[model samples]
Target: MPDDTAKPERKRQARGEKRIEELLDAAAEVFAERGYKAAGTNEIARRAGASPGTLYQFFQNKEAIAEALMARYVVRLRAAHGEAFDPAVAELPLEEMLDRIIDPVVAFDRANPGFYALLADPALSPELASAKKPAQKLMFQRLDQILERRAPDLPAEQRTRTAEVAVHLFRGLLPLIMTATEAELPVLVAETKEVLFSYLSPRIDLEATPQHNRRTLTPEEAARKAAHIAMRSNVTTDDVLTAIHEARAEHVRAVENVLDRDHPREDRR
Candidate 1:
């Protein structure tokens, strides 16, 4: 005999999940386009090709939809943060480490446009803001761990404050980045990472053996100095340095030629 009861229940649950996902995706698009204040649940249902009743079955209102999308984004953000700060890549130069962190975070924000809308929505009440606190807290906790590893000797209180500041600053900047056009985003992102790396790298001890490379440029400093020298040209600091050396060599040869002419080589011989 077929067990009809369980099979129908399973199918119903699967369909429910699919409907929820469709509604959320539609809500994300609508929220991103019109923002939370202007977007309506009916429009979300229309975008999803479902009736208003169907949307109501999954979400009581637009706020409910926003909350659901925020929850989903938080899960994704946590995963991205974990991957960015993976301990396997911890020993990389601070510049590379910051790159890893920034790339994943920017990617996440780009992938979920509605997340920023809801997160930074001016009309959001304190209750809505409270819902996001856990995710923010989780991110800060992960940052604290990263900072602790980078500067193991840093005082616990100081480390906590540093992590909180870093996370808050990043959160504050992300909405602006999200608003930028695609053509302008890379430059903005690059500048942001450069600023962040310059600010944070010196505060932590990242080099494995500092004494071994006393004169060697740390990646952060090297990039900044190189970019300065390169300016608007396709030149690098190494190229500039090489040109200086060649000019010096040519000057030395000219001086030697003048001396030899003034006191002919054969006269000495």
Candidate 2:
């Protein structure tokens, strides 16, 4: 007979949910202070006021901690996106619609300071990116539904293309938003709305125009008026292209600044 002293493999302890929360919170701060690659489990355990043994009881390594944090972030992100892109928002005025969309996203970003750093980092574990897929799909689905409501006659292909462009355009703004100081953030948010509104206005019906003036301009007139406004600001196609290049350069610089301040690669010094 097998020795009675032999025991089954011990299941991981599940008693310290509060302590686990504290650990994850500490991990987020460490990851924010030092990029994930540079962040250490020891520091996280110290910050959480737990012994290494205690932390190991729950998590096998730094990667496990990160995966847990990423899971929490996904839950929050999905909830925020779900609220921001509600179908009823399609009936709201353009400015209100923009506020509804922008406010929750900004709030979410402010609440999860380390999330963008982790999400954008090419060095992040594959598990994190995989976890984000469902949230991404749900976000697009909500946007697609809104688009469908706004322009029921839009061709299926056109609607899909529009949704894709909108998603990519908004996502491109995340780095700038994440890196910006609070003083600079509101302006960036406003500019994001302006850029998104411009892109989306043409694709939807004339409803996005001011209510009193909605019926006044034909699509041709509306296009010309939008162009005229840009012309008044001395903006041209070349100017637009230049701005795009500058924004891309700015985004690259911002990401580098963030990563450098946090993780400072040895050779890059």
Candidate 3:
């Protein structure tokens, strides 16, 4: 109810469960500060202010702690995601809808920085790694469902594609958001909202018109725009082009689809 669907009030009420959460909170901070390869159970226990024996009472090893943290994150994210993607939200103003959705996501990033750390961890076992794919898939499915309702006139393929891009943007933005200073945080968060509004309004905000939805960019300006996007994404420009080249055909087609939909209306004006 506090913008993040039922984060508390269940799954962690008992004394033992509360201790487990305390340990996890410490581990989350540790994992965020140090990569999985560099983190140790002793350090985690120290961070939790528990003896090594106490830590081992609940978790067998560092990997076990990481797995428990991942499992808990999966549950919490699923709950928040369900509310964010609720059909009722589709009736709200576009800005309000974005807030309902984005708030939970930003909260998740701020609270569980370790989730991103473990996501990149090469040492995750097959089970731990496999758990992530389903969660990510669900996120995309829910997002696409909202898009389907909001932009009911758009082609199914286009709607799905838009959801994919939006999810990728969400993933890219979190790392940058996680690094913002307390003073810079609000400004950065507002820019994130602006980015989403601009990307989405042209397609879904039915009140928008071609003349006003987005500004046109010259070829040079578009290149600069792409560079700016890559900067915000926290990825090197060379790395982004390498990824683009790896999926050249698909990337080209995706770009063409976007241009076809958003460019034509401007020309007719």
Candidate 4:
């Protein structure tokens, strides 16, 4: 016998999910316009075209709403990263690469003003702060990967530092770009690209050489790549780095053993 209530229950669940999306969309606009402290639940409900009781059913408070919005955006951001950080993107000249990568971030910011508003706010709650870290970390990791591709001979430590500095510079200027007047907006954005290019070109645009044998990644670069792969698992980067080093040590010993068999041993006179 078919359960008569199954279809109605699924329809109700779908409605609830749709209603939740509406609330989050309304909260995004209100948060951008009025800020978190100023954005009230009643105003959010009004903008969503729902009653206060409807919003209360889904969210306990404004903070919960903000956290939920942030969670949604973090997912969007990871999707953006997938496109922006494609390997082919890294193969482009740095100028075109900047456009490909930076445009998505800027577009995402404009589309969801509330996310940056949360980022710019100095008084953000710890919960909301933690919710945004995945987005931040993915950006950092991808930036480092791009540098690894463009400058395969660069030391891992230096490449990591450059990636860190570039992220900070872009983030520091982002709120300015987001809040700029119409005339100033394009100028500021162009200047921002100029600044990044100026900083990156010196590092990435070294003279080509056959010395590297077609410019493949060096040992350090390969290790960095391995560590990046390991990072996707549930482990700390430090542990991954340590494991990489130990593996390298074993590889070196194996190579030495092969050399000992292939070559005559040197004797002290």
Candidate 5:
């Protein structure tokens, strides 16, 4: 007699993998269309042609599927990195080198907008968050290698810092560019590249004193300089000072808003 229980368990495992793939595909579509917060697990199961119970057998919930999807994304992104940094492309100029670094990321976001949407969610699962560290480290390693080869004169510390800064700057901006209007994205990309290059290679008089030696002004001295400038203009000193205060207040408000959006406040009993 066949071991009936063993056969059924094997079939269940096969079905479970197939069902997980289907669920991930459905979840990706839903996340792209409605975003992570608005997406529903039931809708994903429905699209996958699986019952809710079947879906649950493979994943604990929608968040688990999202985490899996992000893991798959990292795998695909690593492949893209290989493509971007292949030996054939390594001969390109520095500008093209920068493009190679950025293009893979932008292409991935464009190809899998839903997965990118899930990554943008503030409530991302811990597994997905942990996955990001390895991906970031790989990106940093790649950029650091390229910079070392291209700008051999750059100090080791500066190269490391630049790689760190570039990865973060691009990661934060890529999602915004992915979601921006077509007309707006090009402008943003150009301006971002300009700012990055300025930071990496500022024009300096090699013969003059290093920029680090410039006298640092105290807050009071800075304010007095501003006031003196305001006195020469049509604007009153009071008006200038008030404008400065308002700008500071607005900056504080913006930081608080970002914190509130990214983190939950504790409830008081």
Candidate 6:
């Protein structure tokens, strides 16, 4: 005998996984097109040629399906971002870092515009919104690591804050790119770089300074430094100071948690 039952079981499991993928793909498209509030599980099921029961077998409800789709998208985007940043490529000038990060995202958006649209939608629930922060954090952390390697003299607090700002600034500009005319992309990219450089380049200088000496400032020192800089700058410094405080606090807590071997810090992003 050829173990006919074993073959059937394997085939069924493969088919089930395929069905799940199809459902998720369809859900992403539907949610993007119709907006999350307007889209329904039944529609996703119909698009996937599966029943509501089949969807339930894989996901509890529409929200569960949406969360899974978002998670998958994050994984894909992060992987693509990682692949784009070779050590050779990262060694290029500071300006090129903008292109390295932004180009991958722009390419990803061009290929999967729906995901960007879904991210732009305001109807995303609290859970999905919470999930998104960690993804952003991971991407920023990766960029920070690259920056650290290139600018070894930079302070940890400055590097962390700079990375956080760059990620969010890139994200905020995405909607504009999505809506840009064919002739406008170059202008948009140039202006985005200009704005980012204007703000970030000085911080890089601060980080590269020998006085910084790669010192990891305490949370209070980080906050005070950020506030002092903010007072001297044209922008709001309190926001920067607050972010530095949070990042420092979180880092300390994470290290303590690890040493205590209690609840391991969840590096979701």
Best by lDDT: 4
The TM-score, computed over Cα atoms with residue i paired to residue i, of candidate 6 is 0.69
The candidates, ranked best first by TM-score, are 4, 1, 3, 2, 6, 5
Model 2 lDDT tens row, 153-237 = 8998778766665565555555556667788778777766665666677677554544433333322232233323233332332
Among the numbered candidates, top TM-score falls to 4
Model 1 C-alpha lDDT per residue in residues 1-269, reported as the tens digit of each score: 98879999999999999999999999889888998889988899999999999888888877778778889888888888889878655566766887888888788878888876786575786767777666657767877788888788888976775565445435534544676678867876776565455545545654543332344333333333333423333333333232222222433344334434543544322
Q: Taking the tens digit of each residue's C-alpha lDDT, what string does model 3 give over 19-42?
A: 788899999889899977788888
Question: 1-269, model 4: which lDDT tens digit per residue?
Answer: 99999999999999999999999999999999988878899999999999999999999988899889988988888888888888787788777888899888887887789887776565778887787777668888999998998889999987886676566546645655677667766766675565566556656667633222333333333333333333333333343233233333543344334333432234100
Residue by residue across 1-269, what tens digits does model 5's lDDT show? 98879989999889877778889988999999988878898898998888888888889987788778878877887898887766444355434555666667667778888767766565666766675556546766877777676566778876776565555445534544676677766765664454344333331112223233434332233333333433433433443233233223433344334333432333100
Q: Candidate 5: how large is its RMSD? A: 11.5
| lDDT of all predictions | 0.66, 0.66, 0.67, 0.70, 0.60, 0.64
Better of 1 and 3 by TM-score: 1
Residue 184 lDDT in candidate 4: 66
lDDT of candidate 6 vs native?
0.64
Where's the lowest-lDDT run of ten residues in candidate 4?
Answer: 260-269
Query: In candidate 5, which residue ranges exceed 4 Å CA deviation?
Result: 1-16, 87-91, 202-269
Model 2 misplacement above 4 A: 1-15, 206-269
Ten-residue segment with the worst summed lDDT in candidate 2? Answer: 237-246
Identify the superior model by TM-score, candidate 4 or candidate 5.
4
Which lDDT value does model 2 have at 247? 28
Local accuracy of candidate 6 as per-residue lDDT tens digits, 50-156: 98888889999888887888788888888787765655555765567667766776777766665665665656789977766655566677778877877678888
Each candidate's root-mean-square deviation in Å? 16.9, 10.0, 9.6, 15.3, 11.5, 11.0
